[model samples]
Target chain A: MSDGLSILLSDVDVGPRRHPFLRVDHLQAAAGECVGIIGPNGAGKTTLLKLCCGLIRPNRGTVLLDDRPVGGWRGWRGWQGRRIGYIPQQTEYNSHLPFSLRDVVAMGRNALKPALRPLDGADFEAVDHWIAEMGLHDRRHQTFRSLSGGQQQKALIARAMVAAPRLVVLDEPAANLDTRSRWQLRDIMERLFRDRAMTVLLVSHDVEFLPGACERLLLLRRGRIETDGPRDEVLASPSAADVLAEI
Target chain B: MMDAYFIPILIAGAFAGLSIGLLSVFIVGMRMPFIGSCISHAAMVGAVYASLFQVNPTLGALVLSILAAAGVAFIHPHRRHFDANTGQAILLAFMMGLVFLAVALEEGSRTEMLGLLWGSILFADWGTVVVTGGLAVLLVAFVIAFEKELKAVLFSRSLAAVTSAATEPVYLAFLCFCGLILAVNLKAVGGLLIFSLLVCPAAAAYQVCRGYRSVLLAATGFGAMATTLGFLGSYVFNLPTGACTVIVGTLIFGACSLVRRALAISE
Candidate 1:
């Protein structure tokens, strides 16, 4: 509660069809900590991130970000642009949607302003910067459907980061990338995090891809954190063995 | 082959071209072509009641259409609880019931009951033309102004809701707009035949266009084309203009589908 990088979840519950899909009794990710959430498939790792992002409200408890209830934090677009960046798992975007890579990336900026005005000079610069950063300059003008898996994943990351949010929540970003692309992303994330004081909540099953990039870890099992500590400590814990076995 | 009735047919074709084009685009994007059909058919019941009550049949149609649209929205039957199909079914049934009621109320002027079935583009007067034309123009302008916002809804309703877009009100407005258009154009197109104008062009456009904007534009174009060609074909063959227009649209959709398939195979 006293920490500057603050996220507080108290008795949170999320579900589908009134079934207990996820439950978090209490947890906090203080500022400047890249907390890695590792869990089995359907373990509600993504659900937890969704709660923090205010994309889904808890059925029971409160989700507070920076000492304020998540719902009370107005203007999701403004908050996303300035405070939170979300990179969802790669999926087939609607092919019928005509947004170019640049347009998709610009959505990140739009989420910040929620206005109908044109993207200004500064917005263009941010987009260009992130496009280069993600190594997606070549595909910037291409239709989103035309990009390869790795290229699309990079583009998604660039889109998430274009607003330069303080906290970037990446959900299985490396899920669809090749080993080389994954490493490239890791390096890019390292460089980006170094340039600014940022918090990253990365949800992934691939623990190896993250330990070097993340500062801390929260291992989730059946919707509860079984282990949470520094990267090395949690990685070496018995829960890690259990996590690996489950995976 | 140009009869004295050519002027009336021409005017109906023109107005139908614009309004049907706009309607088809909405039908295509919302992926609810059946809803358009259901609404039009249900409007028939409303039109019948209005005729029986000696009131403006179009107004009755509009009210009923809006009610039907709301009913459809409320009874959303998908596991997601938002799909429009079940509501469409309900609407279709309601329209049939209205037709039955209208048949019972036909104590005299049975031809009037038949009027709702086989429409007369030739009987359209200057007032009807003006109203239909204005509605068409208004529909086109509304689509142009709200294209992006509409596209966002088509992309994802949840995303639209999250992004400060009043999606429910927009959706309701669209349905109401559709109702108004249906009511105005009911005389020229006939409720039984309006579904063709609403579905054919948009379905064709969706077969080829990759973007929603282009699909809308193309659907509008195809709608106009179908109406014009159908009118001409109807005149030459001594056929029903409304039904012929729909037939023309279906043919165009078939052609587009063939072209799409050939291109896919070639690729």
Candidate 2:
């Protein structure tokens, strides 16, 4: 309770079967920390991230952000906004609607305002600042769908950052980018980590793609944490070789 | 006598178009054109059945439409396996069966029921104008209120629910609002015309428009124009207003397709 910018999960288990899809006995990410979650496909890496973000609730235990439950079905005016910014992987955003990059990013401010009020000038200012920071000012007027994979990721980053969250959760942010785009994203993450005070939980398959800030790495296997420790120490462990090879 | 019918019908047309046009943007943007057809058909079943029971058809239609709109959500155990369209399809077939059964069971003259089937601009009155107009205003207010929430949820409900508490409520409210609009417009536009109005105008606008606001305005304008054209075509040529409205909407979509092609625009 009253932990500054932290996420804590206790006895979290997902699914109804004897073997839950995801199970976490206890996990906590402290303030200003970058934790990389790496695992093979279907290892429930994404599920764990969802539980942490409060997107999906567990059948067994609790996930708390700071002192409050994640979202917890809190009202729009509650502590939902300005708290956690989540960029989902495989977003269903490939529609024909004409949302410009700026328009898409501005949604990050939704939690800050009530349902009836529109985004004010300061909101747009923040949206613009993040878009510019991502080096996407030229493409701000373009449709988000038209952007390349890398550009979309950058736009998503801008979207998440616009909220000025205390905690940010990104799932496979650089999953399908080109090598150059991947490196650019790594640099961007490094810069963001250096600049912002927010805690970040990143999920990715490639260890090289995990930003320099991921001093901690969580190696998940079969829906559970196989190894959790320092980035190099976890990778150096003998058990990590088999799981990391699956990547 | 002519003035009394003409004024209210015109008002209803405008407001109905405004409301349905705005809602079209939401459904079309989210690739759920089935919602309009499903609700309209569901309303038809309620209207016909209510007429048999000596109840207000609009009230019955509204209730049923909301039920149909929420039909897919009830399959909790199988929600993961059943997408929205699958749920809609199942409910739609059931509603169709009820519509036929209601017609078969009715004994007397089916004047009100028949009016709901093909529409009766002749039956247009002041009550129709008030309901449609109120719905149009509510829809506008809703859009203003939930712009960000809509953007987030429309893109991905799963994604938005992650961070926003308003996601599920906003989405459920949208589905219910759409039902109410369809129910109110059921008598005036009928199922077929209203379905076309829901899909064609917004789909056409997307062909030529490049932004959310522009598409919304364009869809609203096209919808209003289609309704006015329907009125004029019926008045001048003595055609059925509902059929005329459908033709105009279809033509607008066809013409927009051409315009987009002429301008070499991509999806």
C-alpha TM-score for every candidate: 0.76, 0.90
Q: Write the per-residue lDDT of candidate 1 for residues B1-267, one digit (tens) a residue.
A: 476657766776677766877777766656667778777776888888888888988788888888876665444221123345665765687678778778787898777767776665766777776887788888877776655455545544433333333344566677778878877777777888888788888788877775556777788889879878888888789898888888898999999999889897220
lDDT of each: 0.72, 0.80
Model 2, residue B173: C-alpha shift (Å): 3.0
- CAPRI grade, predicted model 1: incorrect
Per-residue lDDT of candidate 2, residues B74-153 (tens digit): 43221243576766667677777888788788899776677787775656678878778888888888887788888887
Best by DockQ: 2
Q: Score candidate 2 by DockQ.
A: 0.45
lDDT of 2 at B262: 94
Q: Residue B223 error for model 2, in Å?
A: 1.4
- Candidate 2 segments whose C-alpha is farther than 4 A from its true place: A1-4, A71-82, B1-4, B67-81, B235-238
Model 1 agreement with the true structure over A83-161: per-residue lDDT tens digits? 5667765432343455567766766664455333445788888988888878788777777766777777777778667
Query: Which one is best on TM-score?
Result: 2
Error of 1 at B91 (Å): 7.2
Give, for candidate 1 chain A, the lowest lDDT window spanning 10 residues: A72-81
The model with the greatest lDDT is 2
